[model samples]
Target: MAKRGAAQQLQTEVKTDEELEKFLARPGLLILEVYSEWCGPCLGVLGTLRRIKLEIGGENLHLAICRADTITALKRFYKRSEPTWLFATGGKAVSIFYGSDAPKLVAVIIRELEKTLQNASRPTYQIGDLQPIEAEVLRIKTEAIKKAERIEHEKQEKKRIDYLNRCTDVIMENLPDIGVTVFGPQVSRDMFKKLSEPAEHLKMQCKDRKYLEVFAKDFEIINYSCKNPLSDDVIDQLDGKELLVCFWKIDEASGPITHVLSTYAHELTKERVAPPDDEINVPHPIAPIISPIKVKFEVEIEDGEVWVEEISSEEEARKLAERKAAEKSKSATHLQDESRPKDQEGAEDDDEEEASEEEEAMQAVQPAFPNMALDIDLGLDDNIVSEEEMVEEEEEPPKPLTRIKRVKIPPIWVANNRRTHAALIYVFFRSQTSGFLPPDPPPEPPHVVMAFEAFKRDDVMEVVEASKEDVPQYGFFTNDTPGEAKLITNSIYKYDKLEEPSSSDRIVLKVNKVQSYTMLSLVQFEPTYCSNNVTSGRMDALKFFPEDYKTDEEIPPDAQKKQKKKKKTQDASGVDESPKLSTETAKSIDIAAGDENTEDSPKALEGEAQTPEVQAGETLITESPTVADPSAVPTEGAPAAGDGTDTQEPPKEEINADLIEAPAVDGAAAATPAAPTDPAPME
Candidate 1:
């Protein structure tokens, strides 16, 4: 069912350097397909190449295959992956066609070949070595390029934040607070498994207090639950009242790697009240908890003489009675007020005006406000929207009022001396595939992620114990696999670098081992060819002009010869106009007779000063080239054969408004090119 050697002819494979070199050395043009077979999309590439070969399998075109396994080979010639083709001719690559479109591929190759043939018929200058002058020019160009790149990078960063801000309503939105716990999907779970392989024993050794202490000092784990579950309901039920409000968080792994990754991914949520509002008299979302839960707001239960704690105090009950009475009065008043037509109309008008003003404010600020989430709570209660209900959602079961004050404490990592001057961590595993467990019981900090606030390993154990009230228990997890460690480490390192300075800022530094060789490849040394044997050189006259010498405006052939004669006569007059043009440019212009006449013009200038010494303070413009006398040119070429030439012409050089305004050039080279071989001069 298959053609013989069809598979051999259509070898969909990666080629070694040997194969690539042999193909490149062949006659005509050889298009080598560079690709990896493991890539799923590469099959389309094979089909495209096959179609191209079928269409252009002629004498002028040839086809080959290449693979990018060898780093050296890839660096030298090919780019990574499938769907890339290098068009080679005469041992040098001429063009590249990318993608898996058959028609497009054929058309590109055909166009290139046609252009190559046409170019072969034209005259071309031999490329000379890139001397000092060219290198200097390149240096300036490179600096300009680098400056542009920096500017662009800054712009992109600003734009990225700007876009994000537009979508979110939070102010200081881009400024992520230092040390905030983050939550996000895992990016490199496999890498973590590999790196944690050798440390698998530590998972068991965690039983030892010393070992546990070490890990606990480095990290802490807590089970974080958004909803109070049966296991965690006890935290709120410990005293006398039913469970009010509780939350839980747990870390999936131990060590700096886990902490950095979780933080970078925003995997940890902030310890917060049910809802955050400025009007809330309770703790702010980012504020710290000063003490454990207080169970009583009405009366206190006493242990012997000392009051152990109050479940509810008499004073609090009285206050609640007063609040209920006020509510009852307010309700009665509202009922009576609703029956009044004037009151009803006034309330309606106020509501409409408030709604209109809010809409206007939102529209005005919409562009600058990113991440704006509109919350439409239809069942929101109206108790005049007091500080408690307005700022923080009411705690379920009607929590007894408790005082919450903010306090500042050093980060646990720093207090426990787990973090030194600086450290770098990378994550290889994410808690996606493998769910994380609650921290185990311990005396010190529990070894976990997102618990940087715990000072000792035992503290982690305390948090773990606290979590056992409701947290799902963690068991032994095995994630070791090839390349897992590297991936995890890199992920953590990236996380640390991306963290805010205030939270985990001490760890950032210059990053290396980045694999952007496309830019680096260009900076590498390569031999250059140019015409100049001198260490430094400048552009030649012909380079500025093409051979098709047609100008938009041209002088007549007779007029051209007359111009030449006038130049010769100027030389014979012993005036050194030759100084105006550079020596190299003069040679390219083929002004040999002018220089020779200069040598023969001593008799003509016998009485003239060589310098034409302008009398004290008189400008040279007052002399010959400017404000010319009526006798400057022979009237209408009265002498038909001026200076032995049939055609006598007026001066070709004329000043224009712009040229006259240009600053006079100092008698020196305008610019110089740098030489690679020469050391740059010290300023």
Candidate 2:
């Protein structure tokens, strides 16, 4: 059966009756055969059917062959011989052919197709068609598509919600705890609420901590342990389980909460360790020994006063020196020896050898002396001098004992703008030989004394008046020699007046010899105390009255009255002696002065004299009126005034004696005022 099925697949063959039915039910015409492969007639008809199918063309017809063994139902239904042919269209049998009659079958199929075409071309009864099944199928397909789309959207939404929930869980797990008791309940609640908002927003957007941190710019996460102790209730609720805890607080106003503290309870998990089962071998240790090594170094010795080459024996050094001397002598007289005879040269060599030997023997016997001249030989009697005699000649007589005056001037301290209340003086003395000898018991010890005095002024004259009671003497050792000694003492003064000193106040330090009272040195320094008070209110009164004086308390009443009277008299004398003109009188004077009329000049003078009533309180001068020199008067065009002295004056005009009024003196006396004898005429 499998072979027959395989053979049938090579050709277009139906495997079952149902497949044959489906083939016949197709829209186009189909021709099918039910055959048994073992039958000779079936084998012979297969080629004829294929030829007929080729003639008909596949587009308009479908040809199929079915094996009897594979499609038993179709063969039984047909009730045909070994090779039976059936023609069908639109699921109905049109013709059937038995046996291998290829020509008759083809002719019959052509005739049937022509009849069908004729029937199709004719105007057959037309019925309006409805495609309800197609419409139903389309509707079902669209519903299925919408269902799939809705499922996808739901899956995406579920995924988003699950992600959002996971993000929220992570944020909550990492959320820090605000200190409830430390920050107070209200503040802690507010901080917690602030922390929750960002977390909630991020959770809604399915964002993780990384994305949440992008928007949370105002806060930071600090890894620190909480300082607050957990309550018993919390511990009980936790059931001793290890859990991570975090603390948070708002870092700034209107900002997210920051994790300020965090802590975690560590799980106590014991890890077991198994001991090694393998045996180990231990090696013996060896100790190391360090041996010290002594290194010897050779140093070249150069001849010097302090550093000299060490000689094993003095005789060897002497011999070396003798050899060097002999070599030098031979080199020095080499030319002389060359010019001399050979016997003379040998004699000179023997003489030099004998002299070198003698010098070496003397050096070996002589004691070494520091700085001794090497050129002087002890062997030469003429050059030798006794050590005692040399010492006596070279030694210098002891220097004449001379006394040196030693004085020290210590730093002087002066108060600024204030009198010196107290001062410390230190005097150190040391003689020139004191540094070489012990500073004790001397033949003549000079007495040293220092005097401290405060002066009101910087001049030496003021030093005499300086309070002598405060000038203390600082004395050094009176009996012992004044070798090296120090005298330290303090001097204090009490001024009769407790007034602060000015910047110009000075202090004088004097060091004097006790016997002669000769002043060795005198230093004067201005006090610098309270310099800032110069411009203050304390000195403001001094600006006007620079001198200080005592105030008087008692005075006679008559003396007071006399002083007042004298002041009034002085004030009255200060007023101007010239009479003061009233406004109207001044205007009258100005008008009279401006008058061009020459005859009015006398009238104007007479008018001014007549105005005696205007000078009520004014004191007017009264003197003898001067008589005019008739010849000294200047005439018109005669030299103008101030040009040259006039030899002859203009003829004097006779004054009207009645018009000229006597000058008034404060309404008391009207007398003629003193005028010059030579009356300078007005130009």
Candidate 3:
């Protein structure tokens, strides 16, 4: 039973010699104990081996026991006594233990195991340990990688160049004259090719011959080129594909070329065509042939119905109607001719006769005022007074004044009446309900207004006379109705010269009958106030009178005296003498008084009327103020409190030609008179 049990235990734990070699070939430490069951030391070492196996566990070291008595291969391979031990690692023999000294043997095994482990852990080779073949292989791989990258870059560059070339060709073909040069980085050929389809489509779409003709005539393309080409990704978009091209138009006169950017294929789509419908065919029989006859027939179609033509056979009716119309037209023309006035020559003769009668009438009725004539014809058609009324007025001439009427008259009225006898009249009407006059007259006078009562009433004359006194600025008159008074007033007023009148101003109204028209004459008066008698005489003398009243012998005494004096002066000088400023002397004075206020400096006097002296070798004579006017007042008044009239004239200073610079007259410089020095005080 013990032998069987030991045999079973040995069979499980102990490995054969071949197995021991296989176990040593593995990666970790392998420990083996060669033993015999009959040996007491071997039996005793079993327990120690078990303890060593536990110390060196399965992970780091493998433990196997070989019974030399039971295993022939291990028995021959070990060739050691019972209880001997062997240690191997990584297929190498580490050490062999011969005696049964458990502690010493275990120590030796552990030391050898550690030595194998240390050797196995160290790298087999140091840095720079590559073989020749490996170095060559690494270099080849590096060169291959760089070459692949370069090829890829070249492929991309080729594609870009191709795209640019194709785009340039297309632009040049379309715009042969546009002198455009394509430039910039290359782009994708696919995008450039895609642009052409739409560009051609646009060219086809512009079908108007006139537009094409105008484009060709107005602008000649000198060059066309790509600017910045589109990218491949952008061109690949489903819609809105655009390519920009720069085109330059050449000027016919060799002027500057116009450069413009044009886009193509930006938005385009294929034209859609509608599908055709199915067709149908049907056969029809032909009519049989027939012989024709030479008979004539006429057919007429009217209002969607056919009929034959027929003549009225009454030709005289239209001619008779036309003849009657002609006769009626002739009668109408004869009536129009009879309705017209007399011929131009006879009418002109009649007008001349009437003008001669009017002239005779005007001459007969001329007024008594000198150079003052009134030609009042009043036209036979005066609506205000009929011919019968005029005849009655002529028969009853204004009765001679029975008594003198005293009226306050303005001085201005007398003054104006003495000159032109013309005046402005203003008429005012009262409101029917209120019986009140319109508010204060307009700023300007000679205005007409409606009256409460008609002018024909006797009360109207009293009202007008009262108004004349109440509103003294405006003249009031009444004759017939207010409407007739307005017409006469407007004709006489003509214009209003005065706006507001002073307290002393007055207006007078005179009513008279001229032929058939009722005439109203107005006389406005504004007083003239003068401070002195001289002003009054001058004002009166300057009054304007008609030319017929003026005569050559009527010249004023003062004017005749002025003309004689002027003639005497001209005779003495042989020419009219007038004082003029000497520009050269004034310029010299301005230059001499440096930095001084011009007003403070003594003024240069004007040259006297005497002829200027001419210097030798000079054409222009520089005139100087040689003689001061005795009547002229001195600008620098008498010193302190003395009157300016008492001041004596400053003595003239002789000019030095060398001190001043004046323009050369003929060949020599013109002499400028020196400015006067400060004047000496009078005694």
Q: What TM value does model 3 have?
A: 0.15
Cα lDDT tens digits, model 3, 162-263, are: 554444344334433333212111222343344345435333222111101111111111111222322232222212222122222433344222211122
Give the TM-scores of the predictions, in the order they appear: 0.21, 0.16, 0.15
lDDT of 1 at 369: 52
**Which residue pairs of candidate 3 clash?**
177-221, 177-222, 177-223, 178-221, 178-222, 178-223, 179-222, 179-223, 180-223, 429-450
lDDT on C-alpha atoms for all candidate structures: 0.36, 0.37, 0.37
The C-alpha RMSD of each candidate to the native structure, in angstroms, is: 34.7, 65.1, 66.1
Q: What is the lDDT of residue 459 in candidate 1?
A: 35
Worst 10 residues of 1 by lDDT: 420-429
lDDT for model 3: 0.37
Residue-by-residue lDDT tens digits, candidate 1, 1-683? 26766645644333555666666565666676665423323555566556655666455567665555552455422223326666666766566666677778878787777766565642222111233443575588668656755665677567654543332212112211111121111212233333233334323121111101112112211111112112232222322321111111223344443344333222222353546457786655553221233232233233443433332477679989999999999999999877878977889999999999999998998678567777787875654678777557755465444432222211111111111111101011112112222222343211111112111223333433444432122111011111110111112223334334221111111111124332122123221112232111111111211123222223455556777788667655545454444334544455533444333322212223233221111111211133144334431202211234322111212111112111123443221111112222222
Query: What is the per-residue lDDT of model 2 for residues 386-504, given as tens digits with 9 covering 90 to 100?
Result: 99989998896865433222222111111111000100000011122233324433322222222222333234224433533222222211111111122221112222132653222
Question: What local lDDT score does residue 539 receive in model 3, on the 0 to 100 scale?
Answer: 22
Off by over 4 Å in 3: 1-12, 15-18, 36-41, 56-58, 69-81, 120-683
